[model samples]
Target: MIDHVYISVTNIDKSLTFYSSALKPLGWKVFGNYDSASGPEGVPDLYGIGDDMYGNGKAVGSSVWLRQRKVGETGLYLGIVCDTNELVDAAYAAAIKAGGTDEGKPADRTYFAHGYYAANVADFDGNRIEFVHKAWNPKRHV
Candidate 1:
């Protein structure tokens, strides 16, 4: 029921480094890129950038990208589904090491109650990404 999600970033290189490493364990990969494209027309416009968003003679500014199909975005969460809470914790730790600012430490949400461990990580643009495990919160309405 969803097509794609777009996020704005201040630094594509840094965002790339952080996301590439962080999302890898979750099975996401950079499926498309427009760093070599010419102008706004070459990039997706829904992300909200001007004609120079990519900048002239340099591909260092905003960019148009796509991630391989996985989960859907609900409201404010990224909705990651992991095999276990332990993996969630590991991913959270990896995100912190990959230049992503930690938004929350791993914890159990008894409301969901299985092993639901989740943590928030901020991208270079301050976009919040979440790492989650359903079992951590069995009462989380699974």
Candidate 2:
């Protein structure tokens, strides 16, 4: 269970637009915005991590506000726990239509074999977020 996940981004408004459009269908609403300095420099921290990680990049139609990291950070997957696979697909589709680039398309994943379906999408910032449902099998050692 993740309380929140944070990343640096370049643009704020475009990120909000793509997320607002893509996340709407998945029943995830932007509960609030974090505009304070404690929040990330460009965009405020967003709530509703349980929704498809469909809109976790910089805002679209804007410049890449942050410098690209040479080595990508491999953080825990921000899983959305959708009610069904259809919701996952819908969120992914909507995100792409709203200016998100495909990190990966919707599909059944083997790792989360217990009925997990998910897809990965990038915001304008190039951060990777995944839309997932029923797809987690964490081992104790892991």
Candidate 3:
């Protein structure tokens, strides 16, 4: 239902490096890039990192773009699915190593549903992201 999500970052270069390593375990990568001059009139430079099944890297299939942060915008929250509880831990570990702040540790989140294992971490720009593995979700993605 969603094409892409644009994340405004205080620094794209730093975010790119951080995310490239952080999301690798979940099968995401920086597949596209464009400079500020390459965008429409006033758009800042964008870096694409996510599951790029659609090939655009800026749209289609989990396209996540990181651009220059705008004033007065702190951040947003996002959830990323993991294939296993182990992957959830791995993602959390990687995120922390990549400079993410620990929001919560990996553990079973029965408060949400049975078999929901997850971890929470804040990105460079303070975006709270959850890495989750939920057996309660569709079988294909879990």
Candidate 4:
């Protein structure tokens, strides 16, 4: 399992506003923030956002951190899982309202398999964000 993930952004405040709005529909909220001086050795400062109810018994749940982008740094893509297709659509709209560029509108990606619904958007920093809902049945797959 992934513990956490971080992405570099050109502007922290702008990115925060973008993410807070874009991810709200998916049940994520801004939870924490850290400065470069307070970060662990060799780690950059970041703004943390994620689902509060996740990883209840563990040290931490899945989270995405937005850090200040360094010179010549490249961006990264992220995929967030949604519980339902409606959430995917909502997230996509929210992202666009938050100043994100639409990569692909919400639709079924049959190539991935049946019941695969997703939407793609590019954040202000041009990082790709995908909201996906996959109706997977473990018993059936097995």
Query: lDDT: which candidate is best?
Result: 4
Q: Which lDDT value does model 4 have at 57?
A: 33
Cα error, residue 2 of model 3, in Å, equals: 8.9
* Per-residue C-alpha lDDT of model 2 across residues 13-110, encoded as one tens digit per residue: 55656665665786555545433445324332343322433233221111112211234543333444454678789989998999988977888765
In angstroms, give how far residue 49 of model 3 lies from its true place. 25
TM-score of each: 0.39, 0.43, 0.47, 0.47
Model 3, 8-73: lDDT tens digits are 888878989998888888788888776666333644577888674534323325657888878887
Model 1: lDDT of residue 62:
29
> Over 4 Å off in model 1, which ranges?
1-76, 111-115, 136-142
Worst 10 residues of 1 by lDDT: 45-54
- Global fold similarity of model 2 (TM-score): 0.43
Candidate order by decreasing lDDT: 4, 3, 2, 1
lDDT by candidate, in order shown: 0.49, 0.51, 0.72, 0.74
Model 1 root-mean-square deviation: 17.0
Q: How many clashes show up per model?
A: 15, 7, 0, 0
- Clashes in predicted model 2: 7
Instruction: For model 2, give the 10-residue run with minimal summed lDDT.
Output: 59-68
Pairs of residues at least 3 apart in sequence or in different chains that clash in candidate 4: none
